[model samples]
Target: MPTLSAADVRAALLAGAEIALIDVREEDPYAHGHPLWATNFPLSKLELEAWTRIPRRNTTIAIYGEALGEDLAPRAAAVLAALGYTRVHRLEGGLAGWQAAGGECFIDVNVPSKAFGELVDATRRTPSLSAQEVKQLIDTRADIVIVDARRFDEYRTMSIPTATSVPGAELVLRVRELAPDPATRVIVNCAGRTRSIIGTQSLINAGLPNPVAALRNGTIGWTLAGQTLDHGASRRFPEHVDAERREAARQAARGLARRAGVARIALHDLRTLESDDRTLYRFDVRTPDEYAAGHLPGFASAPGGQLVQETDHHAPVRGARIVLADDDGVRADMSASWLAQMGWDVSVVEPVDARERGERGQPAARAPQPAESPTVSVATLAEWLGVKAAEGDAANGLAEGHASRAGAGARDTRDTRDTRDTQDARAREVAREDVDENAAQRADEARREPLAERSARSDDASADVAVIDVTASANYVQRHIPGAWYAVRAQLRDALTRIPRARRYVLTCGSGQLAAFAAADLRGLVPDGASVYVLDGGTLAWLAAGLPVEDGETRLASPRIDRYRRPYEGTGNAAEAMQAYLDWEFGLVEQLRLDGTHRFEVL
Candidate 1:
């Protein structure tokens, strides 16, 4: 019930005050701007149902929002207090206070970069690489991997020949898949400074393998350095998508729309659908961040990944026709392909091409048009979709346990009985549709993760476990589980500074998935008697479990012990050492031959 000023919160954060910063605002408002460290848990959802997202009950939580004056903040505090969570406090002046204090806010479709930036600043190390140096290295065909840390569309526009497209948010999830070999030097970049700077920092902060650094100044710097840009289109896509391919993908989407039973409404049909009695499931398959930034009036977000991951969760209108909106045909077309493959009743809502029908008032066609069916009765279709939605809800644990149990037999036994009673006569004709590559991509990512990582988890880990904090110096210093030792997976050898590998280690991360991977990788690297285990659900889960956490960047003791900086044991390559540092800084060391320089093959 007490309130803390912005300065108070800032001081706590800066001094390593372990606390959960909660932004109690609407999703849209939270998306626009929230404190750098805050995680959104809208008060509206808490009004309807308790939130399961926040990490812990006993955590020292600081809640803030512009709407705090509108009773939302107090109510949120009450909910937490009633839930037996002690130490829930409100921000004295809400976001206004934080912003007034010169604090920063962040916005992104996925993992907000502002939070990642804060982590980077905490370590006193900047993620950077010389543009000229990386280009020169690439010219030699050395063992270097360049990654374009921008959206796919951005990559399509322009990128280095050696770079591959990997969006900033997806970097943590997909980095290992792209570069499995630890010896390969990794370089990340974006169009300008912020993303490239922050993206590289995130991976480093997360303790990923491969000596990683950001291409300073990104594509602009590379271009200034006079490097050639490859449009990446020739990297794959066929030169021309023939009529046959387009028709097949279109038909596939149509068939899916038909089977799903969503009315294949055209863009101009919005008025009619709004007036109809039946419920509608309108979707926009663009990025969630884009949707949050701005979207069509009637549509809800069904970003490609979430749509495929939870089709039944979003669209329950089995056999009902669906309406979709996309900026260009690419995303919609890509999504349509997947829905078509899944047997949804779908159709492309083509825009009225202004060129074909002049703007002011176009004349009607001379030929008589066939009258469409008067609202094809979808009452039965609606019911079928509802049943499917209900089933999906149960599968995802969104439904009540009691309701799920009761619906179990109803699905199987009743489905069989209903099938015997109905069937062939009711079979709806599904128009062929095209497949959405986005959907396929989503499906591929969804299918990639094993079941063990996807299931609901608990935080009651074993006691006195050796928890290795597998995060960069910045992330470790920002906030982490108390007593967890830090290890930079990028600098594994250097990580062996203060901590010995002889102890039993439980790797901990923001999410347990990456930590699990690290644990597996470290299995053979540690001493013979030492053992490693993953902290189930990582540090986030640990926080949610009401466990203790502390702040301050985990860093190697100052006065960096330069044990390996002595004269090169195998090859006296002082020139190589100086050259490697210069190339790393300026971006063209490989071209300058290492004459009488240190040469140590990392492999």
Candidate 2:
């Protein structure tokens, strides 16, 4: 296999070349450590995730994994090659080689965004209030509004008292509504450092009249200072956005976007970009409901706020081009500005008639199906297990019958006739039992219920169901069933032990597909009496049904290690984790010195 030395890759990065440094390891392992800017594309999920993640077949893709045990780079390269990726190469000596070449390794995903946020704070000297000071202000009932610049679900999880949810990208668009008075102080916060800093800076950049500041150290700092967070707070920005204010925000964002080199393209130009050899991701940065109402064809629904906050999840390939679309130009413009600053070649499409565009409810990109894995239904496995159990019972019964008859003597013709009649009667009874067992199995199969029904059932006293949300930790924190517990699907074996014991397990994911697979796995693992079923339509269905959802890493059966939360996320993170995270960010400038592949220019 072709290999690229760490030095060469570093040089390319420094020279602003388009390359994707991909780490083919599971999320847990990837979170442990890797080179800066290395996107995780696990070997187990390569076929399913590669197409969308690395969309350009010829994009410079370098695959790496553990240096010692079970090298996955060669196999991962082969898979990519099979998928029509022409420029695939393995990283020389794996991650160790990068370290050997003086490249710095960092923990957690989305390091680029986090590092950039730090860089922004260091340069801009963004104003901030300590937890104690903010508390004093709140106690005094000062004229201020605490804006949590995280996703609404995260805001709901744990927030400073009285903070309203207005995610990062939305800060510029919605600040006017949340605090119309120029004298009202606006305090923006997130779980920790990045979003809070970025959010406060965004308002400053937009030239909002309010005095903007980030909550220092965010909730983590607040907790260390002995302050309490309000859990399950539902305060949010108003549903309606002011049109005139939105237009003003758009104009301001356009200026910032231009300064960051974000391009404004028409539909025809967007088509040209799409047809090029380079990969292009088109997204409609509107609310989910708005996108569902009407959107351009091939544009995925990526709410602008969440898209900016979780860019790595949306677009893993570092050098890929991204196009943002919105009916109101404000969202796309604001989102594109941040993405451009973070080193993506991003553009905002001109607003066009919604009637001319195709509408879709969900994302258009489909995960690639595994080639050799055949679908196995739960019913089939259940039936197989049932047959095995029946056979074992029959074998034991035959042994007992033989033992009981071992000393029997030969009977007269009349006794033999009676024995024959008894045997016929036993056979009829066994057939009836078989019919009843079959009926029971069919009834159990029919009980597979959707999330809505299960949710309703959960309220009943007689129901013994446990909802297992099998999504990444980050997603689970964003939004999930009020009482759902998080578990990584691939780590279900270990996760199973941590989950609460229940008579039935209802598995769910972002969609129902993974949930179905997880449910099947649960059936094999659980005891015979315990039941497992997939939550048809998953959490999305639960939300569609207007059921309550809770935020935060609530009810974690397994360790939150499934994802490496940013050093700045949540309270009570280890001092080492926080120090190590800051050390990693501080060293990124030097790491960039070695790799030179990053084309970042903080505006």
Candidate 3:
């Protein structure tokens, strides 16, 4: 396999060339450290996710893995090559070589977003308050409305006692409704820092009347200060904003977006941008429920706040063009402004005509198909296995028939009748046993244990069980069971090897659908002695039951190989992680210093 030097990769990024620096390790390992622009593509999920992630087969893909002992990059390169990925290469010395060459190594996933947040703070000196100071205000009953900038689920997990969930993107548009009085102080927070900073700055950028600030260092700082956080909180901003307020927000956001150099393009220009031979990501920056009601064709639902937070996950191609759309211009304009400052080639388009709207559930695009596919349909593979089994059974039956015929020739008619009856009775017994065994297998495959039952089992001294949360990293971080381990369904086979040995496995997702699929996959991979069950109704059911939930990434039965941690996510992030992240962000200004490729201009 061909190899690319770390310096060469840096040069490509600097030159604005299209390249994918993929870290082919599990999420947890990948999160420990990687290049600033590197995207995680675990070797175990290469076959399942590579095509979709790296859609262009001919695109340059540089694979890297653990620097110390084993090298999974070479093997990963082979897999990509087999999949018809034409331009695959291994990073010359792996991640260590990159560090040796003075290339930045950042901890956590979504390095781009986190680094950008740090950069924004460094450049703009975004205002903030210490967790202790904010807590004191709450105790004094200050006129403040804390807006949690994270997702609703995250807010539900842990939030300030009186905070309301407004998310990041919605902060600007809805702040007027949340706090109409100019004297009311508005504070934004996230699990850690990035969203809090971004959300706070967003309101400031839009020139909101109220005094706005970030909860310094976010929930992590709060925990460090020994502040108690509310758990399972459900307070949220109103679903509907008045038209007059919406118009005012649109004007404010548009001005800010324009000042930030976010291009306002038409549909025709979008068509031209799409034809430029560069990657383009179109998203509707609205709530999922609103998006489900209606959205432009070819646009995926990516609520503006989450999109900014998880830009890498949504559009891994750093140099790609991102076009955001919304029925109301406020959301997209504000979102585009932040994305532009984060170094994305971002634009906002006017909402499409109602006739141009697509169905609610359609995806932005289909997953890419592998070049030289070696996969067969499940039905076909099952038929093939059945045929092979039947062939063996037929041979055994023939041998038995021959033996019976030979014996029959030497026996009387009455004796032959007895032999025939005995054989018939034995066949019936075997058939009944087969039926019973099949029923048992089916029951095992379809079993769904309720959360209460699973919790009880875990509490039991003798029960041997493992609980796996197969949701995305962001979701798992927001809230999950006390002892659940996070894993991606596509990489479950490899994850299972790392998970503790157990007689039974319980799988759960946001809802039970993905968990059900994962459970079936686990059953096929595990030994017959091992059983798998899906959580009935998944984590939502757990919440409904008012069971306690844990926050932050914890108890990894499998390595946190499913998602990357944002520098701002979780509590007690290492000092090294924070400094390394800032260093990488500082380097980006210089890294993009020479790259004429990014058309970014900060207001």
Candidate 4:
């Protein structure tokens, strides 16, 4: 296989050449450490995810994995080649090689976006209020309007006493309506520092008339400071934008994007980029509902706020061209400013006719399908699970640990305790209705034990059929077939060895697609040649069938390593870890200086 030395890859990154430095290990391993620009594209999900993520077949791609045992680079490279990626190369010596060459290997996911938030804070001196100060202001009924700069779901999960969900990108577009009186102070917050800083800076950049400040350290700091977070906040920004406010916001946003060096390209310019060698991604940065109503052809609905915070997932290949669009004009430019600051070559499409946006709803991903889809109906799977119609009661959402790969915050549990005077560190930040320690710990520990070598337990020790749900770990915790064990698609081969032996094993994902592809891998791993089948339509079908479902980390057949647990994302994350995460954010401006690869020009 062709190989690129760590030095050569580093040079490409320094020169801003379009490249996808891919880590093919499972998320857990990949999250442990990786180069600044490396995108995690696990070997297991390569065929399923590569086309959408990489997009350009001939983009320079470098694949790597575990430094020593069971290297996955060659495996991933071969798969990419099979999937029509023409410029795939193995990283010379893997992650360890990058480390040896003095390449920085940052931990946690979405480092670029987070680090940029820190840089914004450092350079702009973004104003912020401590949790205690914010709490005081709230208790006194201060003239302030708090806006949560996260998805509506996240804001609903846990928010400050009176915060409204404005999200990051909408700060410019919707802040006018939420706090129409210019005298009202506007406080922007997210689960942590990244969105808080970015969201606050966005308003500052657009010159919001009112004084603005971020809720310092966000909810994590709020918890550390012993303040109670309100769970199930329903306040959302009004979607209606009057022509006057929309035009005003469009002018401010266009100016901000221009200052950040984001290009304003016409449809013809986008066409030019598409025909070039560089990989280009065109996205409509608007609300899902609006995107569903009408959007440009071939544009995907990636909410502006989410697309900025999750650039790695949306467009994994660093240095690739990105074009953003919106009918109202504000969302796309607001999103593009941040992407450009993060060193992405980004552009906002010049205003197009509202009539030209003919596409409705999200465009389906053209991922590779499994050769044979051996199917099981959701009703049949529910019967197999012997599920009864009993779901655990949820105050806000279920458990504190939804295994978001430790990414999204709302999926985690809410911390309702008043910790103001308490010194107990054992106090969980998340409300846990039930912690099934045995079930969760057993599956995690037993994964290394080959087969049924240990004493038989009442569960799964002697079952005729085993159902392995391959949904995103967070979704699995939300709802799943009662008796199923949660396993990530990337770790299915190793995961099956730990699960109790059964006559037949059925695999499933959110939709049946992932399960279908994974079933093929399972068929080869079964020692007894057990029949492997997929639940047609996956878990969504199970819910649609009116079948019973359960929630929480009851059965974790695979570890939640697919996503790096953000310090503020889990129930039991240490207070010190949260503090360290803040400290890390504080130091990122310096890290950015040392890296020397970024093109950030904060105005």
lDDT, candidate 4, 173-217, per-residue tens = 989998888999999888889899999989988988999999999
TM-score of candidate 4 to 2 decimals: 0.83
Please, what are the lDDT tens digits per residue for candidate 3 over residues 1-603?
Answer: 899998788777777777788988777788787777888776644654565456567778898985325688876887788788888889998988988877766666676776677667767888999988999999999999999998776676678889999978888888889898999999999877789989998998888988999998777667667788887688989877878888889999999888777898887667888643577788888887778787787787788998887777677666678899988789999999988876678899976676666666634333323232122222232222121111233333332332232222212111111122223333334434444554534322322122334445534532355678876554566566656777766566667776777776777665544565456557778767976766665665554333334557785544554544555444456656655554555565555443323334445
| Better model by lDDT: candidate 3 vs candidate 4 | 4
As for candidate 4, its clashing pairs are 28-561, 400-413, 405-563
Model 4: ten consecutive residues of lowest lDDT = 412-421
Best by lDDT: 4
TM-scores for candidates 1 onward, in order: 0.31, 0.72, 0.68, 0.83
Ten-residue segment with the worst summed lDDT in candidate 1? 424-433
Error of 1 at 201 (Å): 7.5
lDDT of each: 0.47, 0.69, 0.68, 0.74
- Cand. 1 Cα-lDDT: 0.47
Of the two candidates 1 and 3, the one with more favorable TM-score, higher being better, is: 3
Please name the candidate that would achieve the greatest TM-score relative to the true structure: 4
Q: For residues 232-258, write the lDDT of model 2, one tens digit per residue.
A: 687877877788888889889888888
Model 1, range 463-547, lDDT digits (tens) per residue?
2234566543334564555446776442333454566434556665554433544554566576777666665545554433322
- Please give the RMSD to the true structure for each candidate, in Å: 29.9, 17.1, 16.8, 8.1
Error of 3 at 205 (Å): 0.9
Rank by lDDT (best first): 4, 2, 3, 1
